[model samples]
Target chain A: MSDPAAVPPLLDARNIACQRGGRMIFAGVTLTIGAGQSLLVRGPNGAGKSSLLRVLGGLIPCLHGTIDRHAPIALADEHLALDPDNRLEQALAFWARMDGVDRERLDFALHHFRLRELADIPVRMLSTGQRKRAILARTMASGARLWLLDEPGNGLDAASLRGLGDAMAAHLAAGGGIIAASHFDLSHQFGTVVELDRR
Target chain B: MTRWFLPLVRRDLRLAWQGGGLWMPVVFLLLVASLYPFAVGPDARLLAATGGGMLWIAALLAALLPVERLIAPDRDSGIFDQLLMRGISDEMIALVKLIAHWLGFGPPLMLALLPAAALLKLDGAAIMRLELGLLIGTPALAALGVLTASLVAGLRGAGALAGLLILPLAVPILIFGAGSLHPGSGAALKFLSAISLLLVAITPIAAGAALRAGRE
Candidate 1:
């Protein structure tokens, strides 16, 4: 792994607090991850893991503190964030085109995720694992420098999990970073781990 | 850009065509118009007299039915989030969605009115008037529907709420749409045209504001 001090931090979260439904999920949480580094955030169910991911992705309003990023970020939540009625290729192409990524990169990303065969299928027909793979493909195709993945390993088989690990490693090698929140044992793949207690 | 609009519109049109649910509005329009003759008996004059109003009411209701589903699929699949994050201005997003909704729901409802008009024994002039009025009025209904769709996009029972919110706003369109069918009613046509223009002008602003607010 590259030296943390040598690279600027891609994400800086200082004293971040998030509350939902009058319950405090987490408070006074400070964390930072730098370029070419990965931070795995582990927490139990209903512990605001997804909430934190949303806040980081700029989807949900943060209740307190600051989150600074040095590069553009891509977020992949469990919901897949894709139009179900749309063909897989069209949906990914739309997002990729909108994000200014080249078509070649998009095709490569889809093929890498083993989704080239299913590209023409409507998203509603895809199995959970396939849908997750498609979401990952879109995220990879985004070409963002920082990735905030809620559950990168969810619904993936052993081979796909390894493929995901390889993708993350490749992204890091290219001066990109990942902030993955997963319950699985990803310590071997990720450079660092940050575990949170249930509130 | 054609790149954005064409693909989006084409995709939506295909979905609307294949979904089967999109035809419900057309069915409702015909059903509602068919009821007019039955309720008032087989008097040709009575049907003629009430045909315009019946058609307009049916058209309005038809336009209202399928609007809730316009944004529901996107919201459910999380595509709305991706759209918001695409860096397109909220106004443009609202406009694109409005266009899609209009093409999917509005155009078909207008087409469905033709058969209904024939069944109501509307003469050529009345049929022409209804068509013209629908052409102008449907766009406005679509704009309003888009605003309502966005407002209720995240709510339960959004279909009911969409109807409730849109029907009241549609009163002017209804009046004008019906009035246009009267022979020698230039003033009504002019009024309808003016209202249509006003709605077209104001709809973008309302839709844009609502989308921006919702995103924020």
Candidate 2:
């Protein structure tokens, strides 16, 4: 890992607070994740883990906070965000094109996630676990510097879960950062852990 | 913007075609135009005098057929959020959607007008004028459709609300487009294009704001 003092943090959020439907969800939250580091967020049901990830991804605004994002981010949430009518390869390629990554990177992402065999199938035809794998493959293919994953382990089988762990390890080793909100044990070490509880 | 613009437009156009319901608007426009002559007992002179305006009304209503599908599906499926994350502005998305929506429905409606004109007993001159009026007016109607769609995207029963929001705002386009069908009404066509231009220009900003407001 690189020296923390030498490089600026990839994400620097301070005094963050969020609310939904006129009620405070979480507040006074602060965290930082630098290159080659990770942050794992955990909370019970309705505890705002997903909301925090959304806020961090810039999908929703924080009620009170300052977020300084120094690099591009890829987000994987419950919504697959892929075109259902498109083949898995085409769906992922759309994002790859939008992200300006070359075809080689997309091929590597597909191979990394073991999605090569399922590339020709329509996205809607994938099973629950395969769908989760596809979503992860999209994140990997984005070539983003930071990844924000929400409940990424929901439907993955043991092997797929292991693949996810390996992918996360590779991402961090290559100077990418991660902030994941998950209930299942991801089997990866996180440099910082944040626990959010409902008030 | 250039990097993703063409790809987004192409993706949307492919989906619009692949979705397979584009024929609904074209069929609906023809149905309404065909039914008009039946409702008014066939009188060639009467048909010629009023057929062009009736077609304009049918075209306006035809534009509404595709409104519900314009923004709701993409927004619900999180496509908008994903696009926004890619640094594509809400205005650009709205603009692309407007273009895609128009391309999907505009030309087909024009083609269907041919058979509908034959049914209405319209002369060759009136047919040409009506065609020209619709060519300029459909873009504005499409803008209205997309604008209302964005405003009511997340609401329950958005179709009904879309009609309510669009018909009132569409009066200007309708008046100019229909008025242009009258004899020697030279300025009406210019007015029609001006309104169409204004609507097309403002739709992106208005609809973009609505999309942002829906997020909250």
Best by TM-score: 2
Off by over 4 Å in 1: A1-11, A68-70, A83-87, A120-122, A187-192, B1-3, B89-91, B183-216
Per-prediction backbone clash count: 0, 0
Model 1 chain A: worst 10 consecutive residues (lDDT sum): A183-192
What tens-digit string does per-residue lDDT give for candidate 1 at A1-199? 4575766688888899887767888888788887788888888877778888777766666789998867788888876766677789987887886687799999999988999999899977999899889989988899888898888888899888887888888899998889899876763467777777897
Q: Please give, for every candidate in the order listed, the TM-score of chain B alone compared with the true chain B.
A: 0.91, 0.96
Model 2 misses residue A170 by how many Å? 0.4
Q: Which residue runs does candidate 2 get wrong by more than 4 Å?
A: A1-6
Winning model by DockQ: 2
lDDT string for model 1 (B125-200, tens) is 8888888888888887778777788777767888998888988988988887787777788788788888877876
- lDDT scores of the candidates, listed in order: 0.79, 0.89
lDDT tens digits by residue: candidate 2, A1-199 = 3575777788999999998889999999999988899999998878999889988888788999899999999988888888998899999999999999999999998998789999999999998888888889889888899999998888988888888999999999999999999875688888889998878
Error of 2 at B194 (Å): 2.6
